[model samples]
Target: MNDLEEVAGLLAKPEPSEEVVARSRSRLQHRALGHGARGHRTLGHRMRSPGRVRWFVPGVALVAAGAAAAVVIATGAVTNAGAPAPVSGKEVLLMAAVSAERTPQSSGTYWHVTATWLDSEIPPMESWTSRDGKRWTRNEPGDTSDTVVPASISLRLKGADVSFDDLEKLPTDPEALKAWIVQRKGNPDDMSTSEIQGDPTLTLLTLITELPTPADVRSAAFRALAATPGVENTGAVEGGQALRMPDPDGLGEEIKMVVDPETARVVRANLLLTADGSSGSSDGDIAVTTDWTDELPATPKDRP
Candidate 1:
């Protein structure tokens, strides 16, 4: 099982209070995901074995410092009052978020599509790999135990985890974002070769680091966002607008997350990472298409 599934296992323990179970059921109903804090691994994990060849898995990088710097620089060079540019930041961002490939599919009353959440700007993260790691199986569409994750570096996937680091604690604050920047200082440009589309709303925090046991970049989020301002009430950001929870990421990774805008709770989250390179190229030409709706039953077999 993967970290999320494992986490599910933890919460699934016989003690899940009626309220907790109800809450989990509620998320499936309304579909809310909160945004906030957001991660990496290292050498030994980097170099491949004597006979194993290294393959470049897509997505996964800590872009907080660089991304935050980009934000601060953009905000600093702009006007604080009066009518601003017609390309209002809000419009630019909203346009970025809602744009996607597949619209929600409807089968009578049920709509089925992937869900993703946005809070503010997101943080950076990396993946890891390890021998003892059992490919924490999140098993997304087209994914399998053999899925390439640059494992030689000991990197992890977004929903995967290790004993030392828990994926559920991803952080989301300026200080933690800043600290992440420091931690990933050496990788300022270790980014993998990939590009994102300009018009689509991409979830920018999906990352890959290390190369063994698998890790989810978002796993490091909660702790980072614990001290963040504004997001506490869900209405403090963007002049009364909630913006998306766990907003953008410091790294440039872009994957969408869907959460109940009001409650910051996750209903469903999409994990496909788009590439910036040529879309028509073989293997690179693929674009993720997802959809979700309520009427469907919540049985284990009916899930996407």
Candidate 2:
């Protein structure tokens, strides 16, 4: 089982009530993600392990974030009053939340994803899952044939195993969304990637990246991340803004994501070390593409 699948197994317990989750949120807000926060592995770290390699279900292009950032900057029209107001990282996230709320919803037969590693030999991958999240298929690197994914499998979101429908049904209000994720995430001790388990920032980022998530729910996730303490707007990169979250563990590793403020889409996500000045390469960096489509690829049985 992949890390997500392994984590999904631990969620058999009943979901916590709203009241219970609310209390949990209060504690989560106060506690930073690092500082002994368990299971805090990078996305690439988990994806590269011997047997666990899968494109992040709802991933995005690595350079897209940079290009999107450039767009955000190029269109910075000065206000009638003065220079465009300085925006905080929190403000940027909040703005993304608003944009997400305004996004129109879409549906189709399959939730499709394609991804490639930034600077590695990992082959590009394509995946398709039924809208309901029951059936799945994948095109492996260099393989002419399609592989059927087990119907029993599902992606992880906010610490729970969820179908596309479940994603659509997630709470739209920020506080409620936070409560819901924390409740499902349960204890960090049982999770494989400790980086996200107790960390509200990473949890919400994961929600934003997942496919088939309702627009408003994605907005809620952004708002929750913006509300978290210690998030910073580290200035403009290319055309987009860089929003950096706190590093509680003092591991010297920093996590930053680029967002296309215009569309409320996260263009890039990176896990970097403070001393690693070189941006030209990182094994864990990847480009992810996600969408919905009705045309499914023919399986081997349908092929000649």
Candidate 3:
């Protein structure tokens, strides 16, 4: 099996510790009660709501699996011995950029993505966007609900409203892209000293995976992320070696991403907390699966 498939297999069979199970069960119960009383929002609403940041919470059955994946990664099981000696973060990103640049551009009436949010309280979220940027359809399988709306009401990346055209126009040069990202009102230049700083790398990573950006732009994003200071290669984790960066939100957290070396695509991401005298705790761990497809269902499945 391919490396990604192998990682997935390992992640699928977790042996959670008793403490982990207890924590997961408590979190699940808390979420159930909160959602039951407040009423859950539709996927469409959740997507557009700036305040709602969907976090992946492991379920009872998946607790061990997630822990296993993290442990294997922390222990370097994901690294391949046959691979060349480890390179600098910038070099690795440059390699990824080359791979992304060679990828074929996608064109279709709609951009469709099906993502399963493992360990999350919410169900899987599926979205379709019209090429002309006029229509959107979102489906939440857990609730058996679907919502159709204007593309103008779509999700934002790092609080920045962007469209397909904007993404296509992004600079491919790593330096240029870094300048562009830093100049954003939301991204502060003094990340090292500022009490608060936006994680531009997180924003770029989100766009690379969640948007139907052109291959060159995607590559540029990777290169830009590589050039970011404090970003480092954290050996193997899950689908591939992890590239880690400090959380820009100043929540005393760090962001770790598992990226496929062959394709330079992100396989998974984890938000781990940093606290003194505390074992590393994760605020959220997301496993994302994306597809840039040309076709989508003619109608929403659960349009009630």
Candidate 4:
């Protein structure tokens, strides 16, 4: 089996979250009840996921998976016996950028993304966007039917709305890309009391994983993330390495991502509430899959 396939199996174990955060099912249950009473909804459904952690929408949820016990990492590029060398967190991001740069340009009739919330109470969401971002097909959560609508659902980077053409023209150099992100993020100083501060890490992660940017642009994003402060490779885990970043919101939460370096794919990303971070019980999380596909589901007969 390939490396990512092997990592997927390792991820099936139930160890990572234990070391990360003690899950409080009771708190989740209580919050869920509160959501129901308040008529909270996931997009259009009545089931709520988690509050916006300043990085995502209220209905979006992060991904989750199991992790193994932390182990000593490799100190160099390779061992004397030729065994694979363990890499640092920064190294992992750099390597992922290389891999992303080597990816061939591709296209299909539709751009697909599947975002599965870690919370079991919420249903997964599937969406397909037309190449020009003028049409969309979405499988609504808790609804068996799928519908194609004449609506625009563009990919968002930071707070800027971008189309496929716009993504294609993004700067591929790390410095230029960083500047672009900062510009799109807007100035937080001008915001009122309700606006949340921007998290550059989250925006970079979204660019690399979710946006359909060119391979070189994606590589630049990875390189930018490697240089970001507080982004650390924690240690070895079962499926892959675990990388942690300080919670930008200062809400007593830490951001953790399990990534398979081989395929440059982020297996899961979660927000763990540290013991001293916050009294809140919700875990703001997001796991997403984005790709190009040719298959198009049927649309309503009456609507074009």
Candidate 5:
């Protein structure tokens, strides 16, 4: 059978054992509670060796699997649906900017983000991060254990260590925000790189996924992206429209973001290889879900 058939076959298999399901759910719940200010003591119990398994919220995992299957089927039918009218990259970004600006301001004690990282060789890895940048929980599908880390950390933004307060304090004006990013980089030329992996445009793109960033700041970042040169609309991928920009590092890998126009949020981001036979060319993709809530999980079942 071909690759698509193989994927379909795998997804058609029966559900996991109830014991496995229960354990995974319990672990996730425990991790959620560990994000609380008083839950640090429970951190040691969750840490375990990383195993090759697909770890994600069970419900979300099923849905994502279904979605992946649909993508495989839809890819075969995309060409039959006559070509869609081209949309400008700037227009898309501007639309996203407007939507972002309209989002209500919210603050929370813990900023929660659930993300799935995909690669060819490894099973999709799911991770959750807490607000204080102190707790991170990760699991892989089929793995019975969750790896939890509790340490003071900062969200890496535009190559800088940005705390939650820093995110909130970012300038909301597009020009001012761009200037700030430039200043952070030390030199304007530093924003562009021929060998390094990051640049100003890439930094802004990354910022959009960071949930703790204020809505207006995100809006400004989108506006700055709209004004950036080299960004081009890449039509649609898996139902969402995509924008592509050449990697400034000259690595022949394009940064592609599948954007949800109505929400003005990126649904997925990918680093796709453009050059033939590039060694060590492992591509990566991320699917993100953000929750803005002040509630923390209750005390875990096994507290240290």
Candidate 6:
């Protein structure tokens, strides 16, 4: 089996309200919820799934039976590996420490950030942070956190602090994944690759397929963590050397993420509904190639 076929196994693995639910479930039809044909021009905003009732994501591959198990992860790169595996009592202390360090007495962790994508028409470069999932702060920080600057958008996950495998374990819609599933032109069902290069390690997944759409990319990534095995933040699946699982419904797409294991932070990701059966690459005007290679910006002011 291919590497992803391998990762698919152990690696585990939303949407919105009703008016939102209608928006969330529209992935299959690839239509718009409240917008028109012109409004739906970009798949990023319109493609949302309705399964999780909290978010939407990308494509998936039902894993083949007993494909392969046992995956060896690189060191100090898979989440808290630098320290001894926590039991229960100590775990609490570690978590509390992590939280206190990032959270100020009455303020948040605000990091100056600059984001971009292949779509040059991106919003703008500005400051954005969220203290609790509900409120958003823009450019200038103040006492309150219920504002937006349009020019900037912060990266925050609303539901739970889910991991990669979480995507597969969660029940999310399938439509959104399609938009991010890229397999070259005319080779829809073909496979791709995801290469991760981080400090002290370099991990690569072959036949890399599946990703989350822009609309709900954040939640979709957590779903992926749900299913990851042999790793922390592995939502539903257990940890191990390697794992291979079946998609059943391509639910694997939900858990799409490329994170900095040590920092427990995200570096990059692609969520789109796809697998070994679809074809054609979404490129040109409708398609995009967003390349993200940036140092982890300072911790966001409002971190979880």
On lDDT, the candidate that comes out on top is: 4
Worst ten in a row by lDDT for model 2: 272-281
Off by over 4 Å in 3: 1-85, 119-121, 135-152, 184-199, 271-284, 298-304
Could you give candidate 5's per-residue lDDT for residues 203-243 as a string of tens digits?
67656864466788988887787776777775556645577
lDDT of 6 by residue, 94-126 (tens): 222232223222223332332222243423222
Candidate 3 accuracy as lDDT: 0.47
lDDT of 4 by residue, 247-269 (tens): 65564456677666555667566
User: What is the C-alpha local distance difference test score of candidate 6?
Assistant: 0.23
Model 5 residue 119 CA deviation (Å) reads 7.0
Which parts of model 6 have CA positions greater than 4 angstroms off? 1-48, 51-115, 118-127, 130-254, 272-304
lDDT of 2 by residue, 1-304 (tens): 3221221222232343434333333332333232112111123322321122323323322110100121222112234563432445655665566677777977788777665555564455566777555545453422443454333334554334567667778888777877776677432321324334445555566667645678888887877777777667666764356666654434444566677565777666564111000011132454555688897876657778
TM-score of each: 0.25, 0.62, 0.60, 0.63, 0.59, 0.25
State, as a TM-score between 0 and 1, how close model 5 is to the true structure: 0.59
* All candidates in order of lDDT, best leading: 4, 2, 5, 3, 1, 6
Better of 3 and 5 by TM-score: 3
Cα deviation at 193, candidate 2, in Å, is: 5.7
Whole-model Cα lDDT per candidate? 0.24, 0.49, 0.47, 0.51, 0.48, 0.23
Question: Candidate 6 at residue 192, lDDT?
Answer: 21
Root-mean-square deviation of each candidate, in angstroms?
17.6, 14.2, 15.1, 13.8, 17.8, 20.9
